[model samples]
Target: MEFQATLGQIVTAVIGAGLQLRYLEEYPEPFWRPGDLSAAAWRGRLPNAFALVASRPG
Candidate 1:
């Protein structure tokens, strides 16, 4: 079975793996789309995806 993790859990896992947390950005829209959609259409909706940036310690 597959296990889903919360955002905090994922971030913590990354930190535990020796990566320094840099930044994270939550996206309002999904990367894959079923049809054409406008930015205005996503304004009040919840985020469907996010982008995270981390770097390994030098």
Candidate 2:
């Protein structure tokens, strides 16, 4: 077997904001459709919930 080593090698990827992911504790799948999720799934339905992912590799 042959092996290759990588040191401090960084790849590239994309990142964006205003993204939201809502999963259920009982079942990870959405109650309805895949994207048919609201911001008020866990809390008392305040207003908004979101997540931000880094776009570029640092």
Candidate with the greatest lDDT versus the true structure: 1
* Each candidate's clash count: 0, 1
Clashing pairs in 1: none
Off by over 4 Å in 1: 33-44
| lDDT per residue as tens, model 1, 1-58 | 9997878998999999999989998877776665666565355377768889999989
Candidate 2 on 3-54: residue-level lDDT in tens? 6432112111121232232321232333344365555543434422223233
Model-by-model lDDT, in order?
0.81, 0.32
Q: Give every collision pair in model 2.
A: 15-55
Count clashing residue pairs in model 2: 1
| TM-scores for every predicted model | 0.67, 0.16
Candidate 2 residue 16 C-alpha distance from true site, Å = 9.8
